[model samples]
Target: MGSVTTSHELFEVRRIAIIGAGPSGLAAAKYLIAEDSYEQLDVYEQQPEVGGVWFYSPEIVGVTPVPHTTPRGPPELPIWPKGSPAPLFSNPMYQHLNTNIPKPLMQYSDQNFDSQSRLFPSRQDVQTYLIKYSQDVRHLIKFFTQVADVHLVSKDGKDHWELTSRSIITEEQKTVEYDAVIVANGHYSVPFIPAVQGIEAFNAAYPSTIIHSKAYRSPDAFKNNKVIVIGSAASGLDIGTQISKVCRKPLLNSVKTSSELKLEQENKEEVPPIAEYLVDERAVRFEDGRIEKDIDAIVYCTGYLYSYPFLKSMEPPIVTNGRRVRDTYEQLFHINHPTLAFTALPQKSIPFPLSEAQAAAIAKVWANKLALPSKLKMIEFEEKRIEELGDGAGFHVLGFPNDARYINFMYDWVKTANDGFAKEPARWGSELVHLRERYQEVRKKFVEAGGQAKTLEELGFEFSLKY
Candidate 1:
């Protein structure tokens, strides 16, 4: 972590810039707008509209080659002639994707999913909900503008941010200064494909034979082909199930451990991680010495990297190994420079309401309505968290009860700073925590019953004060 001297004087943040108009960015905007202190608020979104990754397009970007040893940086921007279309960045949403978390738990604190939405909302449904939520702050967003760089600039012995952004359509570039910056840009863009032996030769022999989930749109092209799906995470399980239906019998599923092979479907066979790829034989050898030959395609459902090419200029780098962001206190504020904050970095938890909680804390702190702990204390908190969670992706994971506790912690933190004037963020009670805990089980039942249930009560699940 970087070190900085702590000052007792509060830094007056009047102008703020938020990157990415995703769920977290929208939440940040809502909370910041609610505070009457900020003189100007701007949101930079690369996409022409909001919804972030939920905004789906049929177009698929070219896949990064297999055996990616280092973190993948941002794609180079093309210089398009006037009136030419801007480049498209693909999201990792498949055709049949549905929310794993139930609607009640996935929704933002201020709004509800539509009455017609299913228990596990589809991609379109969630996109619609986010678009609706972003209505109030739409004016603050600069669509089709990509933030190219954010670096610290010193003026009057205080640190400020210089943001440079490019217009995706016109290729025009501009630079601006802000008192504070909120990095709500998501971490799900760059795909992380583990390095495997002979992967480059295999790709050369059979081009497009391997792909990350980010490039996958549908299983139609994989029909009747011998497929191997890598990783046992959420996308792996979902995409494996979908591919198994149309592909050959006994789809090879590769996982890190026996515990990850949860699905017991006959068409899917769990195998150990890949030991090597035989380029000549079009085969893969598992760690258990099992070999599968003539494989048609290998889909890496492995997750994405925590990439921020725009913040590359910052000293004491924020991202390392593409697994975690460093120097963050409570996984939100930058320990050395509190003005530069990040939200929606944690995984294995619902994102909507969690983003609201984080945004509330950031909004209050920047508005001088909330006071953060001293720099030394904040550094101590980071050190303590690293001791408990280690220094990897686990540091950002807030699973089960920990996630619930975090939400309430932020809610209470904001309340303490409030003078009964600021808007409150989400505070999960016992009833909501119970719902969040059992949502996976309830979703399973809903799927088994042909996914006809629209509400939790329809599936025999209801909220109770007592856990």
Candidate 2:
């Protein structure tokens, strides 16, 4: 059954539904279409267009529906009190945001960007690329359609998903059943603002000023204001540097010390994580026993919570901790329902390539050209992963060795089908490993040089030129 053949009867897939039309969803559609297996394809996008988080919009969309009130509360209950409404569709991209990964590493295995594209493409470049990828399959997509609910129903003695989707404009709802469902709704929508004492009170005192990085756009809005950017991740660093150009003093608040990782701290003041917000004094206290006064705004780049609001049918829930998707076989298929559901979920890695690989493997699995481990084996795999990776943010981050290992594993799994599907460039896995080594060398040099700020181009060329 895990071997390629022309026998359609061997595979049970019929119609398939993809939740989002973003990069992962688009990749899923592309690979599924390549399989030429499914009879019907339905791609649903809640936004008016594709491109998921890459498509930037200044207009604030719906608020983040309180997850605690939902039937399956947040995977890890947030610090927010009951009934806290967050700005739902806040644009995660800023005007000047560029891809964190180099362009060569960002493309799908079968596709390439424009010849003249930059090493780090901008948000517009990414969105345009996605829109073009969807062009061939746009007819199959239902834009402005949201998957309101996904329920498991028994149809003809087989597992079928009853998808309740609604039009955002007309508020009209429709129900459809599919043989399988791919959830590419993305993990970046719900902002995860860490619980900080007095944060709610501070926001109450200065409405609309304190916001998550999702709500961030132009640095012009932050001009002349003293802003403290939290979370030292990619988004936080980019937003902080951009705001530093206009703000009187832009301070970066992070838990990472110079001893941990060499950071470019020459241009901006870096401080310890905020211990608490002094709402009355319009100040903040750092964990290192320091107090900063007269802060005008606080922008949280604390990343996003893993949200699968539509998935309410699972007994134990897909995401048990709100950080890692639990009980999965290779973190791709749900152990209990491998064929019924899948997720192109990857983190802290080159997203497009990883998604493409995951999608190809899933398509083969659905087509019965690729085999999954037995239920007992899958349970053992999940347990081993949790024990090794630990049940924390580390589980979600497929950094370094883990990312390369997963990608290579999928590429190998896909090849087992012998179905002539797309595969990553020969030796791409080696390149990833080499790239990690080079990146560490670059970081080592920067740290040894006393923490001088360097351009991304300078660091990127170290590996790109060699590769």
lDDT of each: 0.84, 0.70
lDDT of 1 by residue, 1-467 (tens): 22242436587689999999999999999998887789999999988679888987567765676766455477435333356365556678778788888888889877889989998999999999999999999999999899999988877766789999998878799999998899988988878888888888999899899998888888899999999999887788888888998999888889986433344467898899999999889999999899899999999988888988999888878887988898888899988888899989999888998999999888888877788888888889989988998988788999898899999888888888856436678888888898877766787788777876788888877775321
Off by over 4 Å in 1: 1-7, 75-87, 258-264, 464-467
How do the residues 359-391 of candidate 2 rate in per-residue lDDT, one tens digit apiece?
888788888887776677888988887898897
Minimum summed lDDT over a 10-residue window in model 2 is located at: 1-10
Best by lDDT: 1
Please report the TM-score between candidate 1 and the true structure.
0.95
* Candidate 2 TM-score, true structure as reference: 0.85
- Error in Å for residue 54 of model 2: 1.0
In model 2, which regions exceed 4 Å deviation?
1-11, 62-89, 257-264, 418-429, 436-467
